[model samples]
Target: MSDVNQASQTLLDSNPASQRIPPSVFLLTGAVAVIGSNSLVLSPIAPEVAQSLGVSVPMVMSGTAAFGLGTAASALFLARHIDRIGAWRMLRIAFMLLTASLLVSAAAPVAFVLVAAQLGAGVAAGVALPAIYASAAAIAPPGRESKTVGIVLTGWTLSLVAGVSISAVLADWLDWRAVYGAVFLLAAGAFAVLVFNGHRDKVSTEPAALPLAALTIVGVRPLLLACGAFMTAFYGVYAYLGDHLHSVLGLPISANGLVTLVYGLGFGAAAFLDSLEKRVSPRLGLPAAFLAVALVYLLMAMENGTYGAILALAFLWGLANHLGLNLLIVRLTALEPGRRGAIMGLNSAVTYLAVFAGPLGFGWLYTTAGFGALAGLAVVLMVVAILAAYAAPSTPRN
Candidate 1:
């Protein structure tokens, strides 16, 4: 049998009818969609939520910051226990917390309550995200890990395309409270599916080590550095992208949404190429993905004067980003498969840290220098990521 066939057969032989593609991958994707949507939905609905709570928009926006703090703190301090606790069980608890958070937010009578609820949601996200990524790596068919993980990552695209937009519509027509209620329903549905059909996730019998210990493994640090730089670059540019379009290109808020829609489409479309990643060596593929992103940023910086060009580049940008993210997850999880929870927890921590730092750093550059300078900062970051990728220990092609 070929490698692909043999891998599939081995999966079936090892765990028949319990865990495989479609069902397993689909459930994980659904779970991620709920988590990703909750993280994003708050920003778009801040105005409505603020007005309803009788607070300023910025005060209401504190909910997002609270969520970010909770995610970063939980990922850094709490997620390591997934190794001792098991991804399946951690995911269960995370989902329960997430559902409760949404329920609280839906009924919150004050801004403080909303912020507190979102913080709880963030904690759930911190736990749920690593568990979901680790679980994807754990159950994937041997030779198809990249493709499987890529498929699961598309949940972000779904959240971007459907979740946030739908929330906006629901808030406009119904109520902002209804938006949280809807997300709560989605979370509850995913939790039900997880309870009934979720695959058993392996736990380390040895006590879970500190998240820092994952750094001791060779090649892990450089990969994480690359992960940090990659996320920072993307989020930095992304945070200001809509403002750039509106201020520079004279696009309205509605038109700005079109750019995000195009990006989401490209992100989802790139998943088809993930299967090809398995044929290429990580040493070659990893840097190549980073380079592609660098090129797109360069093009955007040079071509930002044109609305049409910026829109077109957004698609390419999303495409490159998805591939880069897929490689990061595949490579990181491959390094020490048994310690995936701890390692991915560190990944989540770095990611949330970027979510905080990126906007501030890039916002400064954007304010003082301009969009070109902001893109320049992104280019510099990507170059650093490229160098780190080159310095990373070379793994043999799977």
Candidate 2:
């Protein structure tokens, strides 16, 4: 019995997030928060960065595409190696690259230099996030995997606020470069903590080539498509939301910020979905969330004038998006426990590629058919996503 208890404790210690909000988990999430915020930093401070680099706002805005491109490319090629390199080791290397990239941005001589730096930083994010997410979920308590994943994901939603508001204030006081500089410090600190933690991760025994070939498997392919569709639909409007609200919904510029804050908080509410996941399999829960998101997008498209309705739907979209993204990740991990890194890389690849498409497609629709049509497109894509999610494999709770 004593031997049994010792064996059990060892098992728990090796499990992902089994210890409940460990400092390592919090630090990992905090590091991701900084990474997430830095990814969006250029958006809010495009004008400042442009002015500093002697370029037009449009020229600086193209950095967004560069970032996405870098992330997509890395997800396809580099992120698949996380299993071999190990998450903790990969995280440290990623921060090294990220810190270097930020410093380059801080001292960039021209717009071209800034763009390159952004691309490099995006590559680091692509490498780090998949590893961090998979590691977080793997270490979670038996039934709390989804919740642990959600806790880590809170960084992304929080970035909407931290990336925009904090950078804006800092830019006003000390040029946009200051924002990147501060991020470098935060990332470096996160790296330092990991170095001292003395934790050694177990290397995966999966074949090196397995991650690249995962796209054809029954377990991963459909979920990846579902994720792609869902992200494209959600970000389509989300990317242009502030501008859409100001132009389509007639909300004042001053109030748009507040509205986004509400949406971010709503997205964070996805953490609670663990309860629902515990009751229902993630496969079923995922499709249900997709249907709900479809409804929200459709409503947002049809009703342009009702301020209350707009706010409600935006918030709901955040909530549902949270559930959808987490479940998809969890399902992918469960589907191929050995290929967590690879599947996550594929997931990230799909998301970044779709993110690039969403802005362009929705922007064009908003320009031509108006907000209603853009929302219609979102609804259409979500219908496809619902089918895709339904096709994914289901694993009942333990």
Candidate 3:
């Protein structure tokens, strides 16, 4: 048999249905890392990127929204096609598109082009990420589905640590554009892996239509709302984090990487505690995490001018963020297994929707109301998420 056929046969021969995570899962996780990082890669140097592109920091921050816009559109439109087109092909396409977008971003001379490139990058991310989730769940051993998800999401967690920490320092030494160049190299590497993997994902065999099935999930509503709040609270500060540190707190640009590393370490660590959630109800665990995040936001806003507080608060936020968000994702994958692709697609759509709104809304608040106002609002949203999680039923839709 040919390599593609041989690879397909290998998948059948030792399917994850009967075993632990396939080694190939690591390859897909690498793809998730780069795609997840692309959305925030410029965040560490928002001011510098703004200056290079001849725009205000807020205007450059609008690129975050543009990315969300593109991703949301894709999550809505393209996710359904995953079953029809096949996951491997969609992943390949996502990889190529991301590579092209990164090149555009690295080479852009003006702000608009850069924003457009981010949008393109988001499109690639929208297609690739949910597909990975869907594929992971399908391939996971019966009881290990959520754990598989945790492993994949840890890629995102590590990327936040490694990508931000390294790129922030590089941006200081080289330039804002150097960050995209580095990501481009990484994306190119992922593409090469996909090319060599030589197996395609099987199409869904579900009875329900993607639209109707996705629309009808009872558990999804509360989860989506909670997720929206989660992203807004995060990107709200995250988009302007560099500015908050450098301009407001009077810290040097180098501090961004260090603080992000602290946050990412906490995030990465939380994955290990995934099994602990079984002891506590999600109703309790989820809301408690949200509450913790709200408290962190409140405290960070009220802190004195010390890196110690910033680092500690961020670590706490990262820990809670990882626990809550990954729990939601694992629950989502299990929510309506029949319509998983569409469900994940919708979940991703909501995520980007929140991302689109967070920076734009928070940027506006930062302009008018100040950082304290933003943090206070985050508290309110977390409270809302807490209530939603409580009100939302624990059972999946029928």
| Per-residue lDDT of candidate 3, residues 1-398 (tens digit) | 89999898777657755666777778777888898668877777888888777889899888889999888888878887776677778889989999999999999899999999999988988888878888877777666776777788788776888787888898889998899899999999999989888886677564425553576777788888888888888888888777888888887777888888898899888877876866677557777777788888889778875888889988988888888776777778777676778888888888898879999989888888777778778888888888877776775311
lDDT per prediction? 0.81, 0.75, 0.81
Descending-TM-score candidate ranking: 3, 1, 2
lDDT of 1 by residue, 187-304 (tens): 9988887788747766778887875888898999998899889988887777667566656666554555567667778888898886677667888788889999999999877884
> Ten consecutive residues with minimal summed lDDT in candidate 1?
249-258
Residue 348 displacement in candidate 1 (angstroms): 0.8
Badly placed stretches (over 4 Å) of model 2 are 1-21, 42-60, 106-111, 168-178, 205-207, 245-256, 305-310
lDDT of predicted model 2: 0.75
Question: Which candidate would rank higher by TM-score, 1 or 2?
Answer: 1
Q: How would you encode candidate 2's per-residue C-alpha lDDT over 54-147 as one tens digit per residue?
A: 8865466556657777777888788888888798888888888888888898888899988899889879878888888878877777666777
Candidate 1 residues lying further than 4 Å off, grouped into runs, are 1-22, 42-63, 105-114, 168-178, 246-252
RMSD for each of the candidates: 4.0, 3.7, 5.2
**Candidate 2 C-alpha error for residue 380, in Å:** 1.6
User: Global CA lDDT of candidate 3, please?
Assistant: 0.81
The window of 10 residues in a row where model 3 has the poorest summed lDDT is: 204-213
How do the predictions measure up, each by TM-score?
0.86, 0.85, 0.92
Q: Give candidate 1's whole-model lDDT.
A: 0.81
Error of 2 at 237 (Å): 1.9
